[model samples]
Structures are given as C-alpha cells and as structure tokens.
Target: MPASELSVRPLTVADMTRFIEVDNIAFIEGPYSPDLVAWQRRFLEVERSIGLFDDEEQVGGATIFTMRLSVPDGRLVPLAGVSWVSVLPTHRRRGGLTKLMRHQLHDLHDRQAEPLAGLTASHPGIYGRFGYGRPTQSVTLTVPREHNTLRLPQGVDDVTLRLVSPKAGLEACRETYARRLTSRPGMIDRPDFWFDFETDDLDQLRGGQSKLRLVLAEREGVTVGYAMYRTNELGPAKGEVRVNDVYAVDPAAYAALWRMLLNIDLTIATVVPGLAVDDPLLAMLEASRYGEPALRDGLYVRLVDVDRALAARTYATPIDVVFEVTDEFCPWNAGRWRLVGDEKGATCTRTDSTADISIDVRELASIYLGGVTLRSLAAANQVTEHTIGSVRAASTAFASDVQPWLSTGF
Candidate 1:
C-alpha cells in the first residue's frame, strides 16, 4: 500500500457497512449492533462523510454534521460539527488521518456555509496541530444529598415543577432548549434526531442505570426549564443520580430545576456531568463539603473563516488591535487582521498594519469565546505583546460576562 495510492472521498450509500467496520476497528470498539447500525443510517449524512481508502479498501473516515453555534451576544451562526473520526490501526502513521482532516477542512471551506468547525477531542494533542483550540471548560460536580440544600430564591416557588415521561415532554423540552441555545454562548442547537436519540434510544448507553426521568418547570403554562437524569445504586441505603442534560431560560426556573435535582428522593448524591465553570449552581449551594470540581476540556473550535468568525461576536469593550495569526493548516487565516469593535458589535478586516500581538490561530480560537484570556496565554508565553497596554485591552474586550460552555457535545 503506497502512500501515493491513498485517496479520500465522500462515502456512498453502498459504502456504509464498510465505513462502520473501519470506524469500529480504528476505535478498537466491538462491532456495533444491528439496531445501532440502523440508527446510524437514519441520522448519518453519507454525502458529508469521508472515506480514506488504499486502492479499493476503506481504512479511515469521519463525518460532518450541519449545526448552529451560539456565539457571544446570542448570535447563532452556522457551524460544522466533526465527529466519528478515525484511522484504522493498520493505517496509522501513514498520513491517512492527516489526509482525512485536511480534506474535511477544505470541503467545509468550499461549502462556504459554516464559518467555524467544532469537535470534542478524544485525544488532547491530535487537533491542535490542525489549528483547533479548546475554548470552553466543562466541570463535573458531585454533591452529597445531605449537602444539596437550596437557599431558594424569592419567587422561585412560584414556578411549578413536575415530572413527566420523556415521551410526553419532548416537544416542550425542545422549545425550551431552542430558547436556551439562542440566549447562551457555546450552546449547539439540537436536531430532532438528537432528541430522539436522547429520549428513546439512549437507555442501553446509560450503563444499566434506571430509565431517564424528565423534569420540567413552567409558569403560566409556558415551559422555562428541564432536566434529564438517571439514577444508579451506590449502596443499599444510598444512590447516585447522574444528570445527563439540563437547560433553564430564567433565573427562577434555573433555581427551581436545581431544587428538584437536589431533592430527588432515595438519591444520596447527585453527579452533574457537564456544567459551565461559572455555573450558578456553585453559588446557589447553601452549604456543602463537596470535593473539588473536576474541570476538563469542552469544545475545540476551528476558525474556518477568520473574518466572519471574528466579526460575528460582540466585544465586551471598545478596542482596536492588529493580530498576526499563524494558521498553517488554514492558510487563508494567516497574516495580519485589524479588529475594531465594542459591546454592540465588531468588524474584522485584513490589514497591513503592524501587529499589536503575534499569535497562532489556535491561540486565537482559544480566546474566541472569551473563556480563555490573552493575559493567561501571555503568562504561558503563548502570546507575544508588542504594546504595553494592548494585552489588557484585548483581553478585556473579548471577556464574556458569563463563561462560555457547551450545552451539547457532538
């Protein structure tokens, strides 16, 4: 198998089975069940998937999902979701993975729809070489039931909370989730297939836990928030409730939902899998002897269209700066760009002006959502400051009032 003979192309309908086999082999996972394969066929866009082949045999592949990303100031822009990426073990180290990724980027660029591409990294070191940066941090918090006290906010009780079957509450949850996506940064819009997968076909993936329970909060018959969770046994007298998904549009609704999770009967501890670093639940806890929160990388973002991505978000303050960004993978993003904006809006244009800061596209993406600051990058020697006050000004302008968080991982 000569490297020169390797080719990457979109998967066809007839290539579905071979693609799945390559995916399972590359990931070292057992063969997917027949039912799972059928589900994959339903949601997977064969045209958007790439197959890396040596001669006529598939050895590597990946898939892209059309998605919407919620950026700063509640701007939802089209995004490309990359997932199910793999290179067969036998094909590793032969440049197959690189070919697949480069081809994927070029295809996305040619489409000209999504300005940004995002993926949750399976390995920390793989995507950075391709110009992806982790912008959001996800925290996993475990609170003992005894310490799950809610110092209820005034009027929180006015919000009615009730338990409903996942089947019955799917529509309301979908509407509330749509509102949450528009109002929050880093959230991704969920498609109908996603709802179907989460509510119906996800039990087998839940590790033998009880069936998922849906909790909804409403005021005047309008859905405001929801929580989806499952309980597992910790011991005879104690149990653990794992919250899979949660969304709240209003403060009272948010507080009310947490109240329900904290007070679920027979559960001695609650484990929240993914929450923002600055989630309000941290401050809402009245008292607790909880362990330190475990923080991990959330979304890895790639700025496919630098100008469009930079101009789409609102800044925190007025500032002007020129950045020389190095993006070897996406050569279009390389060079100096002048960005001028305030809290209302921003404009980014190509410039020959002297660069106030020299950085890589990965570094730029890290701070794109305002979760990681330029100051922090400077401290780590990841950013170079040419002007004395430019670093602070740039950091402040890009800062977000609420930390960026990904509501869903593709």
Candidate 2:
C-alpha cells in the first residue's frame, strides 16, 4: 500500500477484533483478548484516543486517561495520561506511530490539558524521538536463598498477616493505596482503578487477573500494610516469589509484610519488590546481600505543554528560572516560559522571558517526575545554563526526595 493510502482516525467499536490482532502483532504477545480490546475501545471512546489504519488494517493506536495529580500542599492538579501505544511490525518506520502520537498530543492541547503525558515504554529508545523520557527508575531486588534473615519487628506482635482473595481484599488494597498515592509524587489513580481486583486469565493478571495472593497485615483488626505476590518453582528447592507491590504506612507494618512473604512455606528465595530509586527495603534487610538491587527503567513522561506541565507540579524549594523548550513534534510547547516557585507553590506563565536555562522537550520530560535534575542534564549538555544561580535554584526546587515509582504499568 502507498503511504498516501494510509489513514488515521478515532477507533470505533467495530474495529475491536482488528485492534487486538494489530496489538498482538505489535507487542509480539497474546495478552490482549477480544473482550480486553472492547473494554479498551470503550475506555478510549470516553476519553481521548486515536488510531492509524492502512486500508482498513489497524496499524497503530494510543489512549489518554485523566488523573488528578496531588501537589505538595494537598492540591490535586488534573493530568492527562497517555498509555497503551503500539504499532504493527510491518508498519514500523512508516511514521504510523509518530502520526498517531502527534494526533493525540494535539487533541490533548485542544482539550485545555496541561500537556502532561505518562506511559510505561515498551521500548525505551523509541519514545525520545517523540519528546518522551524516563522520569523514574524501577529497582528489582533479588534475595539469595542463604540470606533470608527477614524478621518481624518487636511489639508488632498480635498482628495477623493472611492471604485473602483479591475480590475480598479490593477495598482494603484501594484504601491503603489511596493514602500512599496522594502523599507521593508521580502516582495517579482513577475511579475505575479498583473496579476488578481479580481475573481468571494469566495474561490479564497485570490489570488484576492473576492467581496471586493478597497478604494484608492487620494490627488490632485494622489493615496497615498489604502485598500482592505469587510464588513459583524455578527448580527443585529453588523457588522464586515475585512481589507485584507492597506498601505499609509504618516501619513495623512494613517489616511484617516482608516477613510474611519471605517466609512463604515452599519459597527459598524472594524477589519482594518493584521499588522506587530511594526504597529502603535494601537497607532494611539484615544485609545488603539479602537484597541485591537491580535497576531498570519505569515510567516514561512527556510534557505535552511545557507551561501547564511546569505549573502542575509543586516545587520542593522556592526558586525562579526560565526555560527555552524546543519541541519538534508538538510545536505548541516549543517556546520560552518563566517558571516561578516558592514555599507557597509554583506557576508557569508566558513572558518576554529571559531564559536562565534551555533544553529540549525530552530533557523536560526526564525531569518531570522529579528523578532527573536540570543540573545533571545541563552537565550532560542535554540542558544548557544561561544563569547558573537561577538554573541551580530552580533545578533543586524541582527535585524530589522520594524517587518516583509506578505501582502499575500501562
């Protein structure tokens, strides 16, 4: 088919089966079922979505979801999240993916969205071209069989930790997560996030459809911590337990959650977390050897609109700086804007702004989740400094103490 023959448009209900087929071919996995495709289509129809087709054959697709991002002072800012991007293999290098992304970003801009987009990248290298960058790093730690020395804290006695059905435990999990997500940066939740906490298919388990057990740590009949985990045998006497996610409001509860999962009867070793960059789980263990941490990329964020994205996040310190942002794909974000921050909050506005810093849209995304610093990017030449003092102050203010972590992948 000729390039001009291809067309891009909003996905419809009738395209469900073809969408699933295209996605499976694109991802090289069979996780997307017809029902899942239908659900996704419905979700897209209700939200902002786009698709590209080559003569009736689905080639690419992307969806955007809304989230209320909580700033430092307990203010919730509306955010537009992008996810589930895919392009058919045969359509690679044909600009199908780029076209779909551009359409989605333009749609987001028209909706008065602040141009914040988040997704878990299938291929880390692919998104930078579209002005997306890694905002957070995920650490996967593996505990050796001989180093399993996790113990429950003293005075944490009388607390009971038991496995419960995902269905029975949905409300508790939601309650525990709600508290965590609000206080933390780079975390977002939607109303339907807890709709179905359990599913029968293994492939759909990531979205709550797995045989994994939910362990709730209860003290005085109140749940404080919870972990979703599953154990499988790698070989005889060699078992692996993977923790999907574990959260606790207090130290004792945190320790108790780890103890219960580490001591799961048949498992000799455990991979207990998908931790944030600053997770203390490694230091909490008896020895660092007990938890060998491995780093991997997590969430990929893009600033659809620089001003909106800058104003949406709460700064850690009071500072002022101007950024000359360049975006080739989304031209609306390509300009200079003055960003002001103080103990009160932060705001971005257009001005005859004299820039203290300059960077591409990609670098801005890298710093959006508070993981990467402007100074570091500046040092690497990804960001250029005009006024050193102002640049340093602004960068420091945007930095977050708690490293970003996405509890769930798109």
Candidate 3:
C-alpha cells in the first residue's frame, strides 16, 4: 500500500460496533457481545474516537480519555489516557500504526491539550518508536491460602472490615481511592465512569468467576481502604480469590484487608493480576512457600511536550543539568534543554548551553515518573553522559519515594 493510500478521520458513532469488532479481530480474542460494546460506551466517546480508512473502509481505530495524573509531588497535571488502540492484522507493518500514533500526538501538541500521554501496552515493543517509554511495572503473584500468613500490625484488628455489596460501598471506596491518588506517582485522577473501576459483573468479563465482592476497611468509623475481588470455585481444591483492585493509606488497613482476603474459605490461593513492584504486601506476606513473583509491564509514558512535562513535577534534590533530547516522532523536542530545580520546584527550558547528557525522548520518559533511573539507563548504554558526575546529580534529583505505580489500566 502506498503512503497516500489511507486517510485518517474521526470515526462516527455508527462505526462503534465495527470499531469493537476490529479490536477483537486484531487481538484474536473470542467474539464480543453487544453488552461489551454497551458497557464501553461510558468511556469511549465517539468524539474522541479516530480511525484509519483504506479508501472508505475502516481498518483500524483508537480513543483517548482526557484526564489528569498525579506526579511525584502530590500534584495533578493533564494526562492523555490512550486506550482501545488496535489495527487489523492484514494491515500489519504497512505504516498504519505510525500514522495513527502520529496523528494523535500531533493533535495534542497542536492544540496544547495534554503534556503527557500514557497507555498500558498490549505488547512491550510496539509503542517505543513513537516516543513512549516503560516508566512503571507490576508483578503477577499467586499466594497459596495455606502459608499466606500476614505480619499483622498493632492496630490492624482495630480496623473493622465490612463486606458490603459493591454498589453499596462504592462511595466509600471511591473516597478512599481519592485520598491515595496524590500519594503515588502514576495514579490517575479518575474520570466519573471509572469509579465503577473493575466492579462490573458482566458475564463476558467474569470468565466463570463469581461476581465482584467488595470489602471496605474502616478505622474510627471512617473509610481507610478498600479491596474489590472475585471468587473462582470451579471444583474440589480449585477455589481461588482474584484480587482485581486494592488500595490503602497505611500498613494497618492494608494488612487488615489482606488478612480478610487471604482467609476467604475454600480458596486455594489469592491471584492478583497487578501488584506494585514495591508493594507492602510482599514484605508482610510469608509467600515464598507457594508463589513465585513474576514481573509484568505496567504504564508507558510519552512526553508530548518535553519542557512542559519536565517542569510540571517537583524534584527531590537541587541540581542543574542540560539534556540533548532526540525525539524523531515529535521533532520539536529534539534539541538541547536545561532543567534546574530543588526539592521545592523545578523548571525546564530550551537552552543553547553545552549538553551534560544526550538521550532519546523515550528514555527521558522512562525517568520522567522517577520509577526508572537515568544512571541505570546509562549502564545499559541507553543514556549518554558527556559531563563527569552529571548522571549522578541528575539521577538524584529525579529520585522519588512514592515509586510510580499505575493502579489501573485506562
């Protein structure tokens, strides 16, 4: 196919059913139901949806959730949440994905809508060429019920654990979620639709597991944390508790929630799809007896506007460093820049000074959230340090105690 063969345009509401159909086709998943499409309508608005057409036939499409994300300093900034991205298998390697990605980035940059764009990648290598970087990671864990004893805190039992209907406890859960948003680097300032957050009980999503169950952790008659999970009881010795989402403000509440989750009768193990790399649960659990922790990809971030993205978040240490950033997909960012800041605040601006470090924009994105370090990238030969000891200073400024963790997919 020629480069000029296909055109990009905003898809109409009429294309939604086929839009979903194409996603299912590209992913090679089982057939989708009308209920699936209907439920997705809460977030995937037609206005935000765009598609690639090969002479009037829609071959691929994607959508964006205009939202905000919390950074290292407990501050929230504009975030373009990209999701539902897919291209037909027949259109593979024909420059289709590049076109889609470029169109979206250009639109954001042109309009100055969002400084950062983030996504949960289906495949690890697909998005990096477009200036995206893996900034956060998760771990898959299966903890057996037998040896899942938690090191309890002094006040854990004081926190009351209440099992409420998911719908009944949603307000309390959402409030608990909101309190922890600014504490973590990658937590989203969730949209209204997402308050339901993984509580949907549709049959297509359950995979034969029981409907979502809600547990609220309360201290002093106030909500401190929440955990939503489902149970899979297929046969003898086959029961499992699947923790779809969980959050807390402190050790006691977290331990209380886990103690309840781990002891759910008849479940062989507790399966968690995404656990933060440094989650406290790991330290509290006697899990080595039955589970082997496995690493998994979490969030990928792209800095659409390098200067704006850099200055938006505060630094940990006082430092001055110049970065020679190469962003081929977004050429406006491909130049030398100066970043200066202290523990209080920071600023990044275009500069003509000699570069202290030379790096690709994608690598810069990885360090943007402070989840991955520049010195580590330098060791891997991904970041170039031209000035002696500059990487050490810059990496120290970029350090964060929160440690980035994306609690949910877009």
Among these predictions, the greatest TM-score belongs to 3
- Compared with the true structure, what per-residue lDDT tens digits does model 1 show for residues 1-410? 44656789888999888888888787777557878777777777788899999889888899988888887778887878998898888777888888988998887788776888999988888999999998999888888877878767777988998899998999988888887786657899876688877888454466779899999998888889999998998778688888988788888999999888887787788898888988878888876338357898999999997888899888888989999899999898899999999888889999999999999999999998887999999999999999888999999998887888998888
Query: How many clashes does each candidate structure show, in the order listed?
Result: 0, 4, 0
Estimate the lDDT of model 2. 0.73
Q: Across residues 338-405, which tens digit of lDDT does each residue of candidate 3 receive?
A: 99988788889999999999999999999988889999999999999999999999998887886788
What is the Cα root-mean-square deviation between model 3 and the actual structure?
1.6
Off by over 4 Å in 3: 1-4
Q: Candidate 2 has which clashing residue pairs, if any?
A: 115-304, 115-305, 199-209, 205-209
Error of 1 at 141 (Å): 0.9
Consecutive 10-residue window with the lowest summed lDDT within model 2:
193-202
Error of 1 at 150 (Å): 2.3
Q: Which model, 1 or 3, shows the larger TM-score? A: 3
In candidate 2, residue 189 scores what lDDT?
72
Cα error, residue 101 of model 1, in Å, equals 1.3
Model 2 C-alpha lDDT per residue in residues 268-367, reported as the tens digit of each score: 7788556777775666677756577778888777887888777776788886778888999989888888888765767898877688888899988888
